[model samples]
Target: MNRFAWLDAFLGRLIAEDMAVREVPEASGLAPARGISVGADDWGNFGKSARNWNCRWAGCWAEDLGDQLRVHACFEKDHGYLLAHTDLRRATPILSSHAPYFPAAARAERHLQDLYGIAFGDHPDPRPWIRHQAWKNGEYPLRLDFPLAGNPLPATPADQGYPFQHIQGSGVCEIPVGPVHAGIIEPGHFRFHAVGETVLLLEERLGYVHKGIEKLAETRDAHGLARLAARVSGDTTVAHTWAACMAMEKAAGIAVPERALALRAIMAERERIANHLGDIGGICNDVSFSFGFYQFNRLRELWQRTSATAFGHRLLMDRIVPGGVTTDLSETAARAQIDQISTFRPQLGRLMDILNTSPTVENRLIGTGVLAPQAAAAYGALGYVGRASGVDLDVRRDSPYAPYHTLKIPVPIEQAGDVAARVRVRAAEISASFAMLEQLIGGLVPGPVCAPWTPAPPDACGFGLVEGWRGETLAFVRFGTAGRIARYFPRDPSMINWPLLEVLIADNIVPDFPVCNKSVNGSYSGNDL
Candidate 1:
């Protein structure tokens, strides 16, 4: 952090103008990682950088180490980023909120509040975001003392005490949907404020499916943790697992085999292809185009079936292990997979052309559910959603890691930021992912699939940032005294994009909300956890 004048000076300025500080070892470094901190009294003054929008705020999380709470802030430093942690030692758990500067921090802060019993001053929203009145007051579940089998209410009452915002104008009826939806999807509630047919606002109520992953992750060994990461969000299995593996490997300073790196890239691209196929189809189905849904569902099923043949799981779950990946390609299986992609690409191009030309599809997508580029950037939008809105920041290209370092990936950028633009981005990404997969599969090198294991030194730490199908997925890890996970935080892109969902759906009608929501497709389980 001290390397760059602007970023380093920002912290220097904090120490000079605000509070006395100390420097500790950083949890994870994207290479040359360091940490500096200011006292709790000066925390608010130092936060002025985020408040002034000097740099983009990546993520904020807390670790309760009995005597004190360790809060880490991850933010980008131009092309690279800096990781910093602030140690708060006090009689009471209280600190200033980062939500004032980064709106995305609001959810993370609320999450910390419910999980760790931390209090924040001037928190924009005081309502419970994760707890949902399930546990008794004064009981923080993630404070190391909470039992593994949680104390659940015998008869869970309806969460009628939540203070959802209301409107008082005539004809402005509210539609409350989900937490328990019709489909087999995860739970999340959506409240839409509408007048007649036009939507005035959309407030999201998530965290219904919070599985206490942070708490459970503490008990898992290295191999067990990798398996847990794979299940973080079932659809993002490959991305999440790779991120966890990369972080752990980095912490141990272990180099994965070249062949393993190439194989990991292959698995990631396959996951991307499958998810885009499903999302494109889902967006169409929401707009009453079931034909598109059927076409894509079939393609996705074929893709996953091939994945099962190649990696032994339809969704590629648990295939990415800690040191490397659990995969070795046979010529027969590799060739068949390549041929499947070759055949699928041309069909995808033709179908996309037909849908783009169709008046019904175009009308439902174009100029609808528009998210302004400025708003997108403000909310730290990632993946296709950010690209569609003219904010092109692809992790694979911008911040290259592993196989991506040796390959060229053209990030699809669209300026319209509407449903149609999202569709275009997905279609383009599907083509790009296919081409990348072709390169990875065709250029396989023979080597050991897994690297020899080395136990992390006490407090071993690293950061993993992978561009998942949905977007940039980040995971941080720090090992404990006995080589166990002391602190682990995975900030999903859905957390960043969900807040902006309110912005895009404002002018769109109630009926079109489904299509608009599908365009963003903020992961329910990913965001909830």
Candidate 2:
């Protein structure tokens, strides 16, 4: 059965009634998207489908073409993507908000309101999302004529006047944390409304680090753009770069060589392993599990060092090129990586055994931050967070790209929907990734590292979707004349997962917030953009 068979059947009825436009699910990207373009009147139907279908809400985005504003809301069903869009051409382009249907759509649409001036009708909360009242009204930054250097004004004053909702009660109190943090972390403000230690509401205020990445990308070539995307979030360098490169390659109609595809997959898996190692360690450290922290930290250091020795960068930065990967592994490095996997398996197993049986760790994790599967699906949660919550969708398996299509990728899934389950899922994924890397490296194919390609036609559009360590990542790339970027939008998985953090923290005490937050591990930089 087509798991999303309900969509086609329901949409067909709309088309028959002349209320909905014909769907072109197989017409969005180089590899056709299972999507449709609905009129403003029918946009509500898409929202209904999202609420009723139990679909994974992937992302929502907007494009400002000076003359018109187009909004695209994305969803994932089974192995394919579903895109729903509505266009507005009037003086003030506006449409019904879909955020009521998909909670995750709120931030995305609110962002467009700040950047493109596209208003949403009936949006539940119409607050400024990314724009912190810095730019004056009518100054839509993402529009074509906006100056590259930004508005000539004094440095933006501190945005401290944000209207955080007040919860007034006899014993209720509020705790406001950073847009500036004490540790080596990015800027994001968190507001916690609590009664004693119990948190009643959690508010996340991000976008303090917005670097105008989308605006800056308009002038870059493919190679230059890849460098920028790689830094979208330092921890997810490979994932963001690969997604951007895939869109560039697809737009230019270039096919990467089989060997290059395999190498890309291997490098991606390595990135996944590296991040999970650090996060698992961070989770332990938060709970004062010092022994577990050191053990995981040591393993992560060694793993990243091996990756640098082979890939030429510690975090594999800029390793993924537009058409393919940047370099090949040396024979010595290849053999070492394989051997390391062999030796590391048992070490990982022992550590996992200890963590699994440790009552202290279990007490803090189990049922602490429970994310029901329905909420995960609504939030469009991805990566470990989604898998732990029983929303078992892995882009590598569901939407296979290149080598993952050939290899057996066993996505680790757990339904506990808590910190411990997230930890277990990562442990399982590390083992699977280690073995998969060994197979890919041992069966190495001899071929060129990059693909031969042609320049893309002006205004050509393409999209890339890759499974990053955090979750399903996507990049939308459109080319101008002479291969310059017209528009580039990178949808880091953090955009969707970050809001879910607020939902997860509810009912948890203030002291346990650190462990719960670490479990989700949303990227502030990624979400800020």
Candidate 3:
């Protein structure tokens, strides 16, 4: 059956039940998705219906208008996306939560509660997710009246008093690990309940580095917003920026030049390759496999240097603008990148052989940090984390845009959900990215890189979804008067994937935590934003 056929059928079912639904005209522009508005009372029923049809929960974000608040929930099945949103009066902003149907909604809802002051009825984890008391009570920074500089408390209190879930039992030890770490990584606290070396439970408390990216995004022009999106997660700069630009383009009803779309895809593939290589190396280093560590990092270094030669920036930051890309790929640089990918394949294959055959490496990784397929699905895990556990979904293949709609993107999956499975998935993704780069560069089109910008109507909204290196990245944009950003929310894949770490860490020894953590490598900046 056709994907849209399924979407139509689903809509009919909703309408039959007297649910308020209207098609969004902007869906025909930048994405192959559908959008609808539901009554606030029907929002929970929408979640029930989506769960009944086994829809994958994409993400949810809240927007604050002057007198009301709007909450949106996104779901996917096959190649079709359904965006359901409802408005609530700010005076009484109470709504049913979707956490009961989608476990992934728990953290996002808590985040919405903290930032928007919207009350979610029957939310699973009611404790604040992003609020560490940076602002005083009754101050919701995302609201229009809240100052960008923020109303600072005369004296900010210490954040040492969060009530963590205590596990009490004979011989059960609690080990608290950081909001500050010995390593040079972002701040996050992890509390572990262990009996000897075996971990009984692991709970993570993050939001220590929240930069208020959402609050800062308001009123920025398209170009400024795109630059800000690039920094949402520096490692996934290309994908995040492209997603942001895609959303803005959709909002403005602009078409990017075909050649620019090709260049964008090429840059995105390069980003996926670079991150996977660095992570694969880091995972090996955690297991004391120095040979694999050095070899993979060397490959990553070469890959990035080649990117620098091909693109102006090694990380390709700010390469994606509102309607298209900043620069086009030259024939000479394209040939160099093709050669780089050709040379990388053999070395990667050799490394895979070493990992597959080495008993010592297998002992450390094969069964460590195993996440059940059921658990993966429950949380709506994305990218390799979900794919390794058999939750086979990829935004590129599922909701293709521009060049990806023309290319044959392959999604690799593994049944094992352990650290070894995660490493193998990353390796396979690098190979797939190489294949895409070849297709994108070899069939490079000729045209202008960017389109002429036309301002969107006031209060127009659009969505952007991209398959980032880590997983499905989502961006929501609403344009205000004069084409300024009214609201911008970029849902990094890490937001959904971070909670899975706690699920996978249980039953593993403390020593194996490094490899498990490296395998997932959830971005602090991405989620904290």
How close to the true structure is residue 31 of candidate 2, measured as C-alpha lDDT?
63
Per-candidate Cα lDDT values, in order, are 0.83, 0.84, 0.88
Residue 375's C-alpha lDDT in candidate 1? 88
Candidate of highest lDDT = 3
**What lDDT tens digits, residue by residue, belong to model 2 across residues 352-404?**
99888899988888888888887886687888999998877888887788888
Please give the range of 10 consecutive residues that has the lowest summed lDDT in model 1. 25-34
Badly placed stretches (over 4 Å) of model 1 are: 1-5, 19-34, 51-53
| TM-score of model 3 vs. true structure | 0.97
In the range 101-170, model 3's lDDT, one tens digit per residue, is 9988998998888889988887877888888878865778888888999977788676777889999999
In terms of lDDT, model 2 sits at 0.84
Sorted on lDDT, highest at the top, how do the candidates line up?
3, 2, 1
Please list all clashing residue pairs in model 1, or write none if there are none: none
lDDT of 1 by residue, 1-529 (tens): 2334566566676667746666665545445345666677766666666457356677878887778987877776554666666777635888888788778788888988888888888899977888876676678888878886778888877677678899879889999999888665678899989998898988999988888788888856678889888988999999999998888888888899999999889999999999999999998898888989999999999999999998899999999898888878788889998899889989999989988998999999999999999888887778899999988788898678989988879899999999999999999999999889989888888889899867677767778889999888889888776667777788788888888889999978988988888889888778777
Question: Which residue pairs of candidate 3 clash?
Answer: 178-189
Q: How accurate is candidate 1 locally (lDDT)?
A: 0.83
Flag the better candidate by lDDT, 1 or 2: 2
